[model samples]
Target chain A: MRFFINRDRFVHDVQNVTKAVSSRTTIPILTGIKIVADHSGITLTGSDSDISIETFIPKEEEGSEIVRIEEKGSIVLQARFFAEIVKKLPGQDIEIIVQDQFATTIRSGSSVFNLNGLDPEEYPRLPQVKEDLLFRLPQDMLKNLIRQTVFAVSTQETRPVLTGVNLETEEDELNCTATDSHRLAMRKATIERNNESLSFNNVVIPGKSLNELSKILDDSSERVDIVVTENQVLFKMKNILFFSRLLEGKYPVTKGMIPTQSKTAFKLKAKPFLHTLERALLLSREGKNNVINLKTLEGGQIEITSISPEVGKVTEHIDSIDFEGEDMRISFNGKNVIDALKVVDSEEIHITFTGAMSPFVIRPTDHDHYLHLFSPVRTY
Target chain B: MRFFINRDRFVHDVQNVTKAVSSRTTIPILTGIKIVADHSGITLTGSDSDISIETFIPKEEEGSEIVRIEEKGSIVLQARFFAEIVKKLPGQDIEIIVQDQFATTIRSGSSVFNLNGLDPEEYPRLPQVKEDLLFRLPQDMLKNLIRQTVFAVSTQETRPVLTGVNLETEEDELNCTATDSHRLAMRKATIERNNESLSFNNVVIPGKSLNELSKILDDSSERVDIVVTENQVLFKMKNILFFSRLLEGKYPVTKGMIPTQSKTAFKLKAKPFLHTLERALLLSREGKNNVINLKTLEGGQIEITSISPEVGKVTEHIDSIDFEGEDMRISFNGKNVIDALKVVDSEEIHITFTGAMSPFVIRPTDHDHYLHLFSPVRTY
Candidate 1:
């Protein structure tokens, strides 16, 4: 490949693709980015068996030339060091040439870097996916969905299917759910579907892959097309393509985890509730089990307390906006409660408890569709 | 100790003194900060054997009350946890009381933290300095002096004396030097001396102590009193008494290592030279030796090159602003060169080379009181 591309544009593209390129890839060629240039544009591809990313830089966009092509060829350069060199090279435009035996020369200003390029044929090809089942959603909405639910996915690989976020469409709405057996987070929204009768279900994408994809994606109003296949899925937007493998086996039935009715429900400001738990957790974290207790006082006040014989105790009072039903005390993992509360954007969050022994649920006062459930720790 | 102090004022003092409190301290009480309240003011002290920091807060300052003493007593509370609690407490003023049997209660807003405080008599007392030799200098100047010389101190504890910066006074001039045998940095400044005949020349303050002190001190024109004794140095500033233990052995003589004359001297813009070395080092760092070669071309052009058999090679060209004396080639550890250039504040830095085999020196074109020297690597 012989071309001169804009340094900034090239650096931006390389960073996006490098997220899928892992240094610990069992396939050696997967560690390098596959670079192929034709008369139209250049395509850069990176894969680590779990996820694959391919981005295209056209020769010209909106009558402004981004890359000027001289010869059509292909080569693979070491992704990490080459990316660093190109990013730090001091110039506006960078020239790249592939000579015989796969030797690549990158020149910018008075600096020239010669990097070893692996054979392009050695890199694996990205899996092909059909457009049989496709859906389009705003980039910002998809990123929000990933952020709200991915943190709840199980990091332990005891059950491999629980490590992925379950994304599926039913009727006209799309729902995403993730659970680590202790807590569950679910978010749902309506999306545009290519086929009206398409009812895709049980397509679990690795939470780690969704996190990386979210990080590389830009938060804009632009719509991105997602194509689902039997074993692989592809996300297409602008000139970029992101592919991720689907987890094997069926996801657990998490729809039964969230309760429809509550025994006791109370509304508390999100900020005040988060801070009280944070101070209480400081003492709980010092103890063996990260547990804190919440008690409702005679007045419309809640007492948050954590005790550790070795390192003192702490108690914080949070005035509840409203409280009803039976007054009871509950113990919970303070970290799990804080994590659930942090994502609620509303000023007030409504928490519901079922008989003090069953799992409790927290939902933003203004949001009706999203649900967060936590299993309380039983204190003897 | 019972007092109500301004939250911001107390947090600042705790942070400053906690630098000397090490979590790995052998003395159990040293892991805590000692708080003593008197009729005049309150004092907070922390120590870890090598250094001790004591900061006092008066009852009133500049028409603003900083602390109000309710009783006179002393207690030692865990430094790290107490600092965190005081910093994050939600209140304008914090109330602290040391109850009977050394139980301490801290109250702020609606949050209360009960901590286990140790007996103050168990805490080690800071060393008393006689102040036979004392000098005064602006805080900014002292911080600058430490920054210039501390980076060159030996991190390896093989030779304990090399780990400290050699500081001495002669003829009203204070000079500080630090070297790791491979490179040496020296800075000198004239300060106001209380005893005109005082010439203490054998004090070697640990580089680690100077670094922490520099971090705590603000950049201002206020003068700081430096008290020098037989085995301790006290940096006395506004309401702060910082004490550091002196090294036990004699320091190596580094004054004779800097050459007075050179065979070739050249001046180049600091920014341009630094960028060239940075790009060259990217390749050098990948190589096993981390050595970069610089050669002066026939027509005032300088070229930097580094070669690795497996990773290819790179060459950078820097158009010299000025060159004189001789055409030569020199190889050096690129990291050392970068470290020396980073501290140069001037637009242009002058580099002097004795020969291809000998050491070289670098100094800013506008400053003559500071000098940096680096030994060349012998490449076969």
Candidate 2:
């Protein structure tokens, strides 16, 4: 492959693809990034066992010429070294020429580096998904949906299905839910059908993959095409494609776990709630399960306290403007609710408690579509 | 003891002292920070076996009240947790009250944290160094002197004295040097006698301690008083005292290692040289001793090249307007010179070579007192 490409643009594409390159890959070739130069532009592909990422740099975008193709060829370079060298190259443009036996020579300014590359034919082919089940959604909403619910995904592999965020689509509305048995978070977003009927269910994306995708995804008005097949899901951005293997097995039904009735309810400012929970956690984490107790007051005031037998105690009072139902006290993991409350961007959050031992939910005051539910610790 | 101090200032002092606190300390009480509040202000201290750092917050400085003491007492609290609590406290002013049996209650705004504190008497005593041997220097210059030579200290514990930076003073001039046997970095400065008699020659401060002190130290015009004792060195500032134990045993004789007669000498811009050496190291590091070959051309156009048998090769040319002596090629550890180049703050550096296999000296064009010396690799 012989091509001269803008260093900055090529570097951006290289970084995006390298997210899928892991050192723990069982296949040796997967440790490298597959690069191919064609008439249109250059494509870089990287893959681990579960996820594959491919980014393309067009010959020219807008009025600027990003890449000029001198010849068309393919090669796979060690991803780590290639990324570092590309980033540190000394010129505005980088030229790559793959010679016989995959000895790739990269030149920038007065500096030149020759790296040992492998045959691109050794790289595994990217899985193909049917285009029929593709749905379009705004990139911002998709990112928000992932950020809101993915944190509660079970990190333990004991229940492998819970380690992924379950995606179920009915008509045009898509629901994403993740639960670790003790705590659950759910978010819902609408997808544009665009007349090409797209509806599916039982697609579980590993929470780790979702987190990495959201980290690189730009929060812009650009739309992202999500293609879901029987075994793999693909997220296609402008020049980048992120492919993740669909988790096998059925996701547990979390609909029955969310509490519908409330023994006590309060509408509290989300920021203060987050801070109070964080401070209480500082002490409770020093104790055991990060458990903090909250007692309702006569006039909408709630006192939060965390006591550690070894390392002292912490107490904080949060003032709630609105309160309803019976006054009660409950203990729950401070970190669980703290994580949930931080993702809620509402001015106020409505917290509903079923009882001292049952599940309670903290939801945006204005919206009922998104909420965080957690079971309380039996402190009594 | 009860005191209400400005949270920001208190946290700042705590951070500086905590650098001396390490989790690897054997003494249980050494893991905690000793805090004493008096009528003057509060003093915070943290210590490991090698280094101790104590910073004092005065009641008032330059018409600004930093601490208001309500009662007088002393106690030691776990450094890690106390630092975290003080940083995340919710008020502008933090009130710390030590009750009977060292029960420390820290109240900020409406939030309160009760921590178990041990009696300050249990904390290990700080070393008392005599004030007779004290020299003053600009804090900025001291920091610069440390930065210039500390990186060359041998990280391997094989040579105990080489792991520390040797500080030697003769009359008024102070010289600092560190070498890993392969390369040496030396810096010299004139110390102000200020009517106090101070002269020392056999003190070697641990490189780790010097690095930590330099990191927290401010590069200002203010003077830092350096007090040297038989086995310890104490640096005293207005409200801060940094104490470090000196490494025992005789330092290696590195004076004869610097070559006086030169076969080639050239003056080159430090920046381009640094970048060239950095790039060469990237390729050479894949090989043995991070060796990079530098060929001094007739017109002083230096050609830098690094070749690895397994991974490819790299060649970079550095342009030098000034050239002297015959053409010769020498290979040395690129990382050693790269580090030396980074610490040099000069626009132009003069490099003197004494033949192909001998050690070379690189010094700033304007200064003759400080230089970096490295022995070349004898490649067959």
Candidate lDDT (C-alpha), each = 0.89, 0.89
In Å, residue B334's CA in model 2 sits off its true spot by 1.8
Off by over 4 Å in 2: none
lDDT of 2 by residue, A233-300 (tens): 99999988899998899999888888788889988989877887787887789776899999998789
DockQ (C-alpha based) per candidate is 0.75, 0.69
Regions of model 1 farther than 4 Å from truth: none
The candidate that achieves the highest TM-score relative to the unseen native structure: 1
Q: What is the interface RMSD of each candidate, in Å?
A: 1.1, 1.4
Query: Taking the tens digit of each residue's C-alpha lDDT, what string does model 2 give over B324-352?
Result: 77788999989999999999999999998
